[model samples]
Structures are given as C-alpha cells and as structure tokens.
Target: MKLEPHYLKYLAETQDKDYILLDLMANYGNDVWNFAYFLTRSSDAADDLSQDVFLSVYDRIYSFRGECTMKSWILTITRNKSLNYLKKQLIRKILPVKTVPHGGTVQSAESQLFDRMETKRIWSAVIQLPRKFREVVILDAHYGLTDKEIAELLNISQGTVKSRLHRARTKITVILETDNEGE
Candidate 1:
C-alpha cells in the first residue's frame, strides 16, 4: 500500500486521539501487517506485531513531530516491533511464501499457474537472503520506499542502503540462475 500524500497533514490537524488512531489503522493497517509478515515470515507474529505497532502509535502520538511521512513513521514502528519480536523469539529462519504481484487482466489457466510458480520461486529466493539484505529488497521492491526513506527507516546511511540493495540483487540473480541450472 502506498502512502497518501496528505496523511501527515491530516494526522497533525486531527485532535481526537481515537479518531486519528483509527484513521491511521484504517489507512496503514495492511501495510503494517504485511511488513511484519515479511520480516517474521509468520502470520501469527505479524498479527501480534501489528497490534503492538498500533498501540505504540497510539501511545506515542504526541511524539510525532512530522519529520517524516505518516507512512514512514508507521512503518518504522512496524520494523522495530518486528525486529524486536524476532530477537525475543530467537527466530531467524524465513519460510518461503508466495506473494503474487497484483494484476487485473485475466489470464489462461496455464499462464496463471506458471505466473504463480514464478512468483513463488522469486519470493523463495528473497526470503533466503540475510535479514539486512532481505529487508532492503522488500522495502525497495515491495513497499517502494526510496533509498533515503529506507535508510531512515532502517537506521543506515543512504550509501549503505544502496550497497545492500545492489548486493541483494546480485545475490538474488545468482540464486535464480543456480535454480535454473539445477532444473
């Protein structure tokens, strides 16, 4: 999900805590949960982490100075929560999961099945990346966050983000090539 351009302004102008939070949740809930799932690879953990993220947002609303977009703020919270959950659980394993790209046009059954398999294969390679690399790739490719945004969210320099993204793409290419050779 993409960030609405006026969301930060809307959030700032709103005075009622409940209304602001509900609006945030309505706008960003799926994005938050999906990011959590990408990090943890567990639906259950994503559910818990998303809840905690919203709770933190509610508690820390006053702290938001609008330095960043509202989506960035919410996603930063989600990333921190997911990482903390991973650390606490000692879970570094990433299970492969299919995330089919969204498309509208209908396709033949054979074409659809092939697309699903290809998407799954690509996602499988992605999840196999190290946490640092995987997070950058997902943030860039899936969430469409720019290098500066990702650096801010991940607490790394823009150069580091670029390096990681480059390395991650190289690794993914090698992996897919290997898979094709094996097949």
Candidate 2:
C-alpha cells in the first residue's frame, strides 16, 4: 500500500510514540483545535479537547486500518472526543462557563465590535440547532469542508450531509430573521 505522502512526514505506523505525537501536532494541531473550538465554542475546552484527542489517537493508533485518510480518522476521533467532552460538561453542569477570547484583531475598532456582535449572534443561532445540524454547519460552512469530506469525518452519508446543511441554513435564517424583528 502506497503511503500518503502527507502522512509519511508525521506517521508511519512504525514510529515511536514521540515521533507520532510530534507529527500529529506539527501537521494537525490547528485543525484539531479549530475542530474542537467550533464544536464546543469554548477556547479552553477546545484546548483541553484537542489534547484529549491526541492522547486518544496515540492510544488507539494501532486500531487504525487505513480505512480512511489519516486526517479524517484523526478528525473522527476529535469529533467523538468533543462529543464525550460535551456529555461530561452536561453531567458536571455547574456555574456558567465563559469562553474568553485570547487576543488580536485585524479589523478596525468600530467594525470589530459589530463584527463580534454579528459573529456572536450567528454562533448563538448555530448553537440552538440540533447537534447533527450544528456539526454539519460548522464543518461545511465554517471550516469549508466539502460535503463528501464532512460525510467521511462524520461517518455519515454525503446526502445526509447535504440535507442537514440545508436544514441548518434554513433554521439559521429564520433565527436571525426572528432576532431582527425584535430589534
């Protein structure tokens, strides 16, 4: 089996744990973090979840049979881990959890506030959607993953991805419009 060149740089299924980890971080760290953040909408949770994902990946590496691309598999693990994290959060249910932004800004100050508010509004609307719809919206709309790629990452059919995306978009539109009516 010809190894994917991208995977070759970071993983070979024959390397030591450290090398595997280094490769995973070097190649997919941001993606894992982004995936986690989009799902949890909590940067801190995303950081923790990203680490958990890699740990799980290391523990489960041997089980990977190359049934899918390495990234897809890693993302699948991240998705599962995020879901688990969400479940744990629900159980641990405590005081309000706040997601603080770290730093940096590219837009002008005036536009930044509006942009942030708009982004927050959209995110709030997205969060209100069902989990399946939310995931599809983030993966396809925010992360720019293709429907086929999302299907593979989500372990769902492409048609399902398409349908969910459509439903999500419709719900989001209605949500934003309803909010506008109030304002």
Candidate 3:
C-alpha cells in the first residue's frame, strides 16, 4: 500500500510537482478529509483544513526525513492543521466575530435523523476524552490503524495506544449511558 521511498523523493524533487501532487490527492484525499473531519467535527472546516494539509505537504514535503510512512507524515500535517483550526475557533468564540449567514443542513429520513443523533452523541462523548485518548481513538476507530502503527505515528509505546483506546471506549460508554439515563 505504501509507495517506495525513491518515489516519495521524486515527488519532492520533480519539476512536475503539481502533477505529482494531484496524484497524491487522488490517493490520499479521503484519508486527509476524514482525519480533518474527525478532529474538527465540521465538514466545511475539514474541507478547508484538508486543502491546507495538501498545501503544507506541497511546500514542505522536501523536509520529510522518511522516518515514517508518507501517510503518517501527511496525517501529522492534518492533525497539526486541525489543532490550529480549533485554536482559531476557540479564539473566535472568546472574541466575538462578525459571522456570515449560512444555510442550515437539510433534513433526511426519520431513520437517518435517529442515526445522526446517535452518531452525534457518540462523537460528543469522544470529543470529551483527553487529547491523547481522543487521538488514539480516532486514529484506531476511524482510520483502522493498528496499535503498532498508531504507536509509531504517535511516537508512543504500543501498550500506551492499547490502554488509551480501552480508556477512551470505556469513557464514551459511561458518557452515553449517563445521557440515556437522563433522557
């Protein structure tokens, strides 16, 4: 699934960098988008953040030391960008900003509404986790990365990834259970 190192170097050095970038987008766009969405929890923000990740990759990929897979490198960019986006959002909330009016989301089927509500509740629970736990949970549950891979990506031990995942799941269960009891 991973391309060779020489090919990654070519992408960094080639004159046809735009073409190479487009090809990279075709391969990794979904992963970038999903990672952004998982972190930001906003489709619009995720779209912008995903584009920013590609832009950052295009500009700085030559600096990639090949310490990890290209996917991890780009995803690290995404994670950083999403965190930056969240910080900006927090600042905006702290300081009132002139906001533009946007249309609301369209309604779907009743079943879809129920599913969306459930998903929203779960995500809210997930978002409440400590940053370490949330990151491991998202990388594992959303991206299907192995604990070993996550440990490498996170620069932590595999045991840490496993334990954090367990804690995150347990926390989410308690949160949802408490919510259900309240309802």
Every model's TM-score: 0.90, 0.75, 0.71
Model 3, residue 111: distance off in Å is 7.8
Model 2 C-alpha lDDT per residue in residues 42-105, reported as the tens digit of each score: 7788899888989988888667677666777888888998888888886322222223233565
Better of 1 and 2 by TM-score: 1
Question: What is the model-wide C-alpha lDDT for candidate 1?
Answer: 0.88
lDDT of 3 by residue, 129-160 (tens): 76778889889876777787788877889999
Top model number, lDDT: 1
Candidate 1 per-residue C-alpha lDDT over 47-116 given as tens digits, one digit per residue, 9 for 90 to 100: 9999999999999987877777788899999999898898899887777695657787999999988889
Top candidate on TM-score is 1
Candidate 1 clashes between residue pairs 3 or more apart in a chain or in different chains: none
Q: Go through the candidates in order and give the C-alpha RMSD of each one to the true structure.
A: 2.4, 4.3, 6.7
lDDT assessment of candidate 2? 0.77
Residue 25 Cα positional deviation in candidate 2, in Å, after optimal superposition = 2.0
Runs of candidate 2 with Cα error greater than 4 angstroms are 1-4, 40-45, 62-66, 88-107
